[model samples]
Target: MSRISHLFSGTALAICLPATAALADLTAEEVWADWQSYMSSAGYAVTASEVVGSGSVAVSDMTLTMEMDDASGGGAFEVVLETINFVEQGDGTVAIELPASTTMNMSFQPETGENVTVAVDFDQTAPNMVAAGDPGDLTYTYAAEAARMALQGVTIDGITVGPQIAKLDVTMTDLAQVVKTTVGTLRSVSQDMTIASVDYDLAFNDPESDDSFQMKGAMQGLKLDGTGKLPIASDVQNLNAMLNDGFQAAVTFTTTGGNYDLSFSSETDGSGTANATSTGAAFDVSIGPDGLLYDVSQTGVDMNMLLTELPLPLSFSAAEIGTRFLMPLQKSTEEQDFGIAVTLNEFSMSDVIWSLFDPTSQLPRDPATLVVDLSGKAKVLFDFLDPAQAAVLDQADTVPGELNAVTINKIELDAVGARLTGSGDFVFDNTDLATFDGVPRPEGAVDLTMVGANGLIDKLVGMSLLPEDQAMGARMMMGLFAVPGEGEDTLNSKIEVNDQGHVLANGQRIR
Candidate 1:
């Protein structure tokens, strides 16, 4: 192939090659060597398995392996190893035709008794990278297992059991600087369990601590298929709990200049006879450069089955469920900065109700579907990093710098056939949220609005949960908050909820 100079211009940029008139006779090996050297010198720690055969102009086959150590200071405990299988073509650039595969195994021990080891296997492929001068297709299959989960001095697992596991496969087109790093299709198989020691508390005819009791299930056929250009600075971390101390992070993500759509689905099954499943559901996720511009519309699902006839003494049927969120997080730029808008199309809840009386889906109630349409936005205070930066946040509260200001843009909620709106600014004081010094406290206020105070008052009255006099008082209060007679409905009430979860609406404390 002729050595045509490549120029990368837009989001999916390519490696630009300088145009030259003098055509030197550079072989495939020479080109590969130059590319390898350039990457290695740029801190890639490049290494390849021994090339099996030798050729200059057109080497047909070879394998290249490389490991990228985590420069994030977490130690060799964090590293990415990749091996690619390629073939040299008639062109000067080699064809990275197959995905580069990698496997990772690491162990970590915190001051707490949590011990974790992760085993990961995945392959990434990009065809005609150097030759086509464009990022090629990439696909990966990966699996992970994590054990021994603990939180706040409470051990959630018995006998150091495994509680987190997953198997995943994904495919993307023009992945590497080619088609804007947006994901195409991703499918995953997962199993997770959480068995609390409380189940063994002697108060319930429980077995000894040494006796083994477990709960485990598998989520199969989980898939997410989507397309859009990946933003240059987007959070694309392939999230793995075992590998990163249970901290939340995205494993792989990209920014798409244009809008894109995606969907997800899965089912759950288990070790025992529950035989429960949640299925036949889907989602539409839209992506844009600004943020997640999504219109979420999905059904919440639940299925259950009884397992009492077996060896154990539990008679309640199992519970299976699913839920989805379709919302748009507006861009922070001035053009769209007022309030974040969101909508939840349909939310359904269904479960088998066990009756010492009966045991059949017929006896169980019909599946319930809840249609919710909500839109709202709240101002963000500061970055919410898990466990990290906890101390700094605590200090900010004590001194009252940025912590003292109310942070919000706007918020709207349309759920369960009801609509409500709220906007408020709150300070991170000693008890509202975590303080800058690591102290935990709860303090915040939310100003809310709702349509038809009189209609709302009547509903509350019919519910009979509140006294008639109180309901009347509430009606009067609603009148005070009522918006002008015509335009849009409104309610001007400040809901002050304190550290102990005590709620006070318009000075009347209600916990």
Candidate 2:
């Protein structure tokens, strides 16, 4: 006897074996029914026009619909699948396929105006889904060959605004998920997708003008990978509840290398061209109980552009650009902390572009850099994602929170022959906005040090980049606020805002 059979004995085997076998021997119809039930539980209305066969079932003209109501307007979305096929294998598995195209339509009804409709058409080549294992612990895999998609139509307030896409090709190699029936949850899911190429041409007539505008562009080699965990019970009906209860996800997108050439033309204003190339780019994002975090970085970015009616083209390049953001999760009316940083490294402009402003090339040709790091705390006034809360926020005149404190851990700028570095910590007095002309009053001092400013100004004056009168005015302003530093051609300054509404620079009252 098989080991599985050996685990059971005569009468006990007869009783429990059949039950276990029934759970393991899931049919195509059962799988489809379960999907329908699950979607319905998640607030979607699912329907199918025809369901044929038993073990190997084929469904036709299936649709899923969802509706959302908001203060600004209400919206409804419907997705239609032309056909789907499911074939049961003898090895306790079923193979599913979407053999035809899919279409989605969204309509929004504004509170005081007409409705708007947006439609999309998607194409695929029998993308497959394979399911296996027992009912309580099933696994499903999804994969697809290269496919195309395009925007079909768009209409707003009964006015047709045509939208189109010439071509978009996508391919997916790995996608999988595990479903746990006992807890009614998806244990985990992971996916990786690649966009092989994209070519597009779009045109729209100006509503107020007789002239029309058009744009054309192309790109290649974009990739995306993602993984997620849904700790909440999948059977939960409320979508917001699922997110609030337990949800964690992470996704990363990157470009393997690509070039894009975009051209824009207007019937009345001539035309322009822009070309860009990059070696690689990446963006990563995550969300969990700790809150949201994201990082974006790109390298080898080079661009050349000519604006309409411009005399010359502009060119620039950067070795790398990056930024990061973090916000702690706040589930209640409590204070939350956040951090942000930005970087611009090894950035430079072509001489042809720089000569327009600096004819003598007085500025240094070395690459420039700018970096900033900041962190702060604030009390969230409402649920940021809730439509009602958003409506309230939009109606308010100012942001609905008191900024407890802000710290500028680092601030650095390097360009031309000048370098500036500064750091500061500040506290805001939200109620004293009137003292700062409707802006939150800040009470603190920022210490700054600058190098090479005097030399840069002298060079600029010698190159005639700055008029003598303007240069004198600039020096006078600096003398009034900044004090001489220990180093040659260097200066130091302390900008302070006191509780008595006084603005001072280097111990001298300025305001």
Candidate 3:
């Protein structure tokens, strides 16, 4: 049996020291050899001074540098972290501290972007680095006035917001296994002549699996605030390259407990030929144990874009987007389960008619009040080798191919204040969609009912999706022939799709 003990001083961080005389059974050279062996096996290239300090163990400072290799290939690039003058506390922790007259240098390269180099110096005694206990305490500090960014041609809002210089002051405190960890703060100072005001702060903590994440700060207040119109050729080139030589907007979202909040905004103007601007937007939602609850609100968004020679000038403006919604997530292990809910909201859009239409009062004559309710669920996978989740494999990422056999239990959507509802359910065999090139395509049945036929038809006609004459004629036909199992005013329809992609309405295939 063996024992290891680490020292914890009250009001101070715990430090690693040589094991008590009980382990005195080993000599200094023997201990150093063991240390080197341990670090190498754990994937670190370790080096240290040979001179052993007084007493039995070889007590001396050491340096360690580690870098990842791409052989394991999960991501595109590898990670590299470097630390100089890392003193091994002999117990288990390591330290990198500097006296008043020390210099530091480090470089960082992202997955696919410009390289940033940072150099730091200290005019005072920096913080100490302690060992890693169940939770450990480690601190370091550096005076900035030496950081630089070399972004060849990056600009924002018509301003060349690159070729930057700045200084950073940082302090870090990490406590392992303990109840809490505190990372003090970071402060950055930039050159006085700098035109843009860009500020950023970020912090996070994940104590254990059972506990939730704690966020202390964020990456915010990064602004390119300048009133003068500036040359933005460099900015345009960089943006075009990043967007595959054009303009695009892509966003991803993740939610837990179906609750979230997000906000964004931007604006720009420059050169007589091109101009762009943006406004505030936000999304907020919460799903309580009671049921699903959500709220979304946004405002002031417009993109008046022009690419010469294009027939349709791209223009848009949004006054607001707001919604209140509720729904429940239900499930059962044995029986199939499903849930339903709806959202009540208003969304306003304005089409900019720069040439032929009035720019003022750009809002259309009719504002939209959108009401949508939806319900859906899936069946449990019964097969072990070929699961049901595989059936809809194309719809998701990280889905096991064996789970494709699972079938949809049911799905339904209600739109326009419940005036319309469409629903269907289906089962699928072990077949891949791509391979369906030869086999008969899967088949499914659908039922749709449109109530308030006359009013709905009028709304459709107003939107120009349906001509007034056609809408009136459809409503008149519904009046002449009553819907099966329903009244004359409602339009009831049945749809059947076969393996050959042929569709049928009311038992007649319309291929």
TM-score: which candidate is best?
Answer: 2
Task: Provide the lowest-lDDT 10-residue window in model 1.
Answer: 1-10
| Model 3 bad stretches (over 4 Å) | 1-162, 165-423, 429-440, 444-454, 462-465, 469-511
> Least lDDT summed over 10 consecutive residues: which range in candidate 2?
9-18
Clashing residue pairs in all predictions, respectively, total: 46, 0, 19
Q: Report the lDDT of model 2 for residue 103.
A: 57
List lDDT for all candidates, in order: 0.33, 0.66, 0.34
Candidate 2 regions with alpha-carbon error over 4 angstroms: 1-30, 41-43, 50-53, 70-72, 100-121, 133-138, 151-221, 227-250, 267-270, 285-295, 322-332, 339-341, 389-399, 429-443, 484-487, 496-511
Q: Estimate each model's TM-score.
A: 0.40, 0.76, 0.35
Residue lDDT tens for model 3, 24-60: 1223343344344433322335555554444233333
Q: What lDDT is reached at residue 36 by model 1?
A: 48
lDDT of 2 at 459: 87
Query: How well is each residue in 8-109 modelled by candidate 2, as lDDT tens digits?
Result: 111110111001123476677766665565455344577887556757878776666655444334455455556667778776677776654665454555
RMSD of 2: 9.5
Q: How are the candidates ranked when ordered by lDDT, highest leading?
A: 2, 3, 1
Ordered by TM-score, highest first, the candidates read 2, 1, 3
